[model samples]
Target chain A: MALKVIDTIYIEEEIKEHPRTIDISSKFKDARVLTIGKFGELFNKKSQSFRLQKRNPALILAKKAGRCVLPAPKGFGIGGHKNYYFSHMYNCLYDCSYCFLQGLYASADYVVFVNYEDFLEEIIEKSEENPSSVKTFFSGYDCDSLAFDKITGFAQYFLPRLRKIENCEFELRTKSINIEVLKSMEPIKNCIIAFSLSPDEVAKTLDKKAPNIKRRLDAMKNLTDQGWNVGLRFDPLIYSEDWDIMYSKLFDKCFEIIDNNMIHSVSFGPLRFPKAMYKKIKIDSPREKLFIGPFEMNNGTVAYKNDLEKQMSDFCQDQLSRKIGKEKIFHCVSDVV
Target chain B: MEYSYSIRFVVALEAEAEPIIEDYGLKRIHEINLFKVYRNNLANYWLIVSGIGSINAATASIFLYQYSNANKSSFWFNIGIAGYFTGPAGEIFLVDKILDEVTCQTHFPRSALTKKIKRDELLTVSKPREPLSTSHLIDMEGFSFFDVVNRFAVRELITVLKVVSDFPSYGYTKITKNIARNLISNILPDLREFVAEAEEISHKELIRLRNPASYNEVISKTEFTQTQSKILEKLVRDWEEVFPERYLIKEIDGLKKSSEILRKLSSDLNNFRIDWL
Candidate 1:
């Protein structure tokens, strides 16, 4: 069995005495604890190896002093006129080779902003500015929402608060199967429980330490059957020799247990990364075969060639469209919003 | 059969390596002044004795590393006698943290090391003292040892092991070369356990990087971008890992362009099971 032992905990001096820090401290009683003036003091520093640090990473609890909520990139969150994202955490527990987070930070240590109320405050303010227009808040852009839920208990503390804002929507995107917290509480309708999926073959090669495809599908089924609005995210799709057949089988397996009415939305996109991120990931994971596949640079992004990208997206959309309503599907593009 | 030595030890004194050198049956191979190298061909081991002080430790570590042409899996360790304010002599501890008194900079060695031995922090000072300033173990060369070795080796593969030599009860004056050698000789078994584990880790890495030179000509012939260069390295490594008996060089000889070489390699690798090994 695995143990919940963070190699170290670098607490921010400002919030060293905060109750959330105390609660996080209680989770790993035996972790080696240290105090830092700020999380960025060590986190943003260079020359640290992300791949090596992932083997034994520390947890950093700090306060986000500025910009608690920022607008998400174009076409990120589906079914919203205005979409903003807030990250209580940076970095992730799973070591997916395709994950962009590996290149975004020099260190693999988890820097969790313990100031939840501040994010909620900004969220409430934004949602109230236009009471009639619905806005969505996307989590898991940098870290999996549920993978670290066991440690962060982010949902436990913030799920109830999310219910307070009638116009705001939440999307807990993840590849984790640890949904015990959601299973315990009554399903939140405004919050969409999105599960990122890839074919089992693609996942086996790329998604290190992430829950297997079968388990994630089961978790999605359990949530959707309980009346929770679920979303299927096939973004950054991997191309393979039998990709069409593989994705078809995957859609069949997912729809087998998931009710058509419960799936609030479905989205798919090609595997793409900003050039800088691709450059960093190439160095970080030099031996990973995923980086070895053929890719071309297009408008500062490194991804599959244009024809292949269209083929992959078209095939995946065609597969999902056969079993689901057309209105439920969305292609995540830069101008989609 | 000839054994390839992967684990290396750099000590401050010959007496520090005395028991280790003798017990491991290491024969002296290279020497210059007080700096000496020992090897046991059968066990694939290397031990170097670099005099004293941080400068000497740094120099000798680099010397042995270059002389031996060590790889990433090679383990570089600095083992010596240290004095703590309270610990009794012959007490073994792994240094998890090092504070350089002269530089006032701290270095934390990777803490993922085995817990078979007790762990402690060490403070490297310029000169010996009558009383300790902090509770950390005081040594003469740990911080410097890590500073230089870490540049060329994996942090997890480098470490500092210290056996307590003296405390307030028994000052440094009472300690001699023979006493230092004796204290080290007593903990030989525990030290062996550490080396064995480190050697085990190095052996696993050996399987991946083994004979990477087989595709050197093909890789050198191509002009790949920085990112493509890295991806090409993985493709070649994966091919070598999965089909070590097959030759990638012969297959690449007919390919004219870089794209052809990469496309051919990637096409072959796409069929591989990532966890085949």
Candidate 2:
């Protein structure tokens, strides 16, 4: 998808002089720049519509204060004893129907924390705190890691710093094909550039403004061919009458271009959400057909029925195991009843 | 005659409202005495004259909203004349930010309209004021107009548009009723285009809020508790999404209980196979 033009930029008074802020603002010379005391003053304000703001969203540059790194939720890692995640950005460029960011944030504008050193410092401190264990730090929890890289220069700055850290694995989860910076440099063995995947039909229908599945698959192939460790993520597996056939074809297409040995790991997660979040997203997007699917409240969480969940998980696990080892395939089952 | 409008305009004076009223061919509604209200016979637009100042603008907007029975999906616009720091007295601007001089509060109106029109920050003062060190467009009703209308509608559907009437070189006393009318008259074409876009957005929102025709038919034929009514509403929406070609009313025609009707609808939706191809 073509990048939407940035017509307005809100700068926090604290970060107005920051180098990153200046660099980003200089690119959009014509965009109107407004000063504010804090990003939350505008981003967290009520009466803002996520749907409407998605049409013409502004960029808010701010200095991230307080704790920059937090422990990852349980069952959200790739076999690491200590897992953590950091968000240098809030909100995504793509408007996926099932994205949790829409319900988590009231405004659809992008918030880029200009202070990247603080996040890196905390990651190093945490990794050094437990030097013996393989601590994994996940990026792109709240936003796509590389989708805004052209403007944010996220990977170009963070990859070099993260490469020097000892016994730390970094994961950049994305559905973007913005890989020019990644292709220019040597692949970091410790970093895994994970791409979120869905069936072509499903991605086309649900992942609005995101790169098509074909483009994503091609990016992964190119990165893996250049010796970059890439991972496959089939998350929030959308269910339909012919889901099995569609997913089977998807796996065949993925394995056709990407070598099995180059694949770092494969993870599949069932479509699920906290009950309150599901309710909010449903209200925000009342016409979205994905919300009207076969989902039920299970122990304060909304997910597919037990039988349906099992059928999907078992089918995906069985299909993926045929090509990759069982040890490399992880089932991301949340702590829901 | 009762007419439903999706776009409501709140102007501070009749001179500012006349150009729009004439351009849209709006007829005055005699029943609404609290505010001077005009609406087109096509039932898509309304304009109200709130006699000058922030409080009057707020109260008149509320009055027009209730009197017109506007829905949450409707668009609200505050259009009038304002003083700018350096203006030729005919420039139009879409207010992106409103700073209230008295309250020291600021509001950011979501501007989803096209960027072809120039945008400016507005300062809503308590009374008439001259240009200050800042380059903000000065007005008397923008802040309160946004502050109140936002409570009734989403910020995206709310806008504040201003046409510069006086600036540093031209004093406020030089402005007259005819000048204000002409200033607005000159921009009627652009204003009409902007309203058309807003109307299209409101129309889509209305469609999203509307349920399938079968929902009303089923509700009229059956007896349901309040909770059952909500559940049946969701079930029918799901039925429409899953099986648009199928007729839901015929399947639940003879079903008396809400439970039976809901079950039939749910079963039909569940059993239907969705072809992704």
Candidate 3:
């Protein structure tokens, strides 16, 4: 089994004398050289025809400033209205079995677009279109916002611009220990640093290269100490044997570093995946026991039986509500907000 | 001298690769990833079952190349289990070439590749988990060796060999993990000689890569935390300034943004309490 790095060709016109792209070459030292084909051809290749292209992942760096189609940030919420989300990078450095990006993309290599100015311009224009005054932009939907904090300076370039906008808010959702990025920058009131958590046992088995829950919590503590807004996300909650204790302890840990008054919002959801996508992932790694179970299919999605899902969600909601008020807790689901 | 080489066996899985080294009395030069390297008296070598994916293979190849760096000439026989396209559960293959099948890039060159091995037109997919396909042979790490050794111009350095354990139809389930574990243990001696012969090379133009001096300047210019600064301090000390200064700087910038984004998102949500009905 080789490093299986396909190939990456340089595109000079995209970014001018960018230093970050040069750094990517060194991280993958001695990686083989492959053709640099067009963007649509390389990233969107799922069929067998383009297999010969040797699609080595590339890191693109550009400036993104503003845009159109800015989701109404205040009136609508994430399962409720237009929430504008953007991915500066596609694919992650870590390989997790349940990740959707694996089935969604053709190549395993990561392609980072080095354009930050362009993204900013679009966000600025969209935010101005609505007079609601409060616009929220979501990062980490396609990729973990902080996982590669060492590779791309996303938060650094985007945060200053967001702070200048009167009714704009930004979310940095991640499972990374690299919070030092925040400590060095100017503290803006409109930003919320969200941490994704699971039980230690579950993370050890599934999170792959992600920093353990403890490390992430510690990072959150450091950020909160510096007067930053923090939130907890227990997403895609994988069911384990000792359900009650696993979640209770996870909550206890979060409330330790976070001020009860400063906690922004908390959300939880059950483990689920698209049926066809799940099947493809199962074929990619057949030995994974997590996928081979009595999963219930609900609304073209697979999850625990309805009763089990209700039980897990209810238990988490009830117990978590005791520590923090019910008002700060929200369940992120497509069906209801 | 024109050399005639035949690939004797290709055993997949690190567990299987280890016992074979013991059974064949091969010289254990390096233990990288999962595979333990062994060689014969003639200097013929075998890179035994290393591990289960491209990352494992690449790491093992780097270790192997470093171990053999001082030798006169060293060749490798990438012998292990692989998934195949043809029939017969136990058919043997001389995989003259290793392809990334997905990227379709032959990252390595033909001269550096194991010879007399047929270019079976098969693919080696790397998985961090278990092999989900019903292909020919499924081992953890192989293509990485094909990739690294070639770029290093050490291709004149090896051979590729594989043995089919389960046909494509069996769904890779029939071969129990235990049965598949012992495949390499059964074929150690033959693989060692094939590698020993390929290690021969005459020294003429040994290409050495050049270093850029700008790295040191970046390190000195950027501001880093005590912990961040400490990491940079150690890295610079160990490798005489080829360390990635720019990567460290960008990391510093990223950490700054992450904290800023979180702070902004949180404060915006504060004081907004909507009771669920």
lDDT of 3 by residue, B4-112 (tens): 2212222346455666556555665554434566655444334444456777677766665565442323344566665565455445565433557456664322333
TM-score of chain B of each: 0.82, 0.96, 0.52
Once fitted onto the true fold, the runs of candidate 1 whose alpha carbons sit more than 4 angstroms away are A1-4, A36-48, A128-133, A279-287, A333-337, B1-5, B42-44, B130-134, B204-213, B217-235, B238-246, B249-277
lDDT of 3 by residue, A18-74 (tens): 565566555556433333334443344433111111123344333333442244323
Location of the lowest summed lDDT over 10 successive residues in candidate 3 chain A: A47-56
* TM-scores of the models, in the order given: 0.86, 0.97, 0.53
lDDT values for all models: 0.80, 0.88, 0.56
Q: Give the lDDT ranking, best first.
A: 2, 1, 3
Best by DockQ: 2
Q: lDDT tens string, model 2, A1-337? A: 5678899999999889999999999988889899889888889688878888988899999999999999987888887888899999999999998898887878999999999999998998999895999898999889999999999999999998888985999999999999999999999999999999999998988899999999999999999999999999999788987899999999999999899988889999998888877877877777688887678788888887779999999999999999789988988876422
Better of 2 and 3 by DockQ: 2
The best-first sequence of candidates by TM-score reads 2, 1, 3
Positional deviation of B275 in candidate 2, in angstroms?
Answer: 2.5
lDDT string for model 1 (B1-277, tens) is 3233388889998888999899888988754444688878664677888888989889989988877667766777789998988857899988877889998886767633555566778899888775485577888889999988888875667879999998988898888999999999988988888887777766754543453555557768868777777667667776775567888888888887778988988888755533311
Q: How well does candidate 1 score on lDDT at residue A87?
A: 90
Docking class of 3: incorrect
**Candidate 2's iRMSD:** 1.7
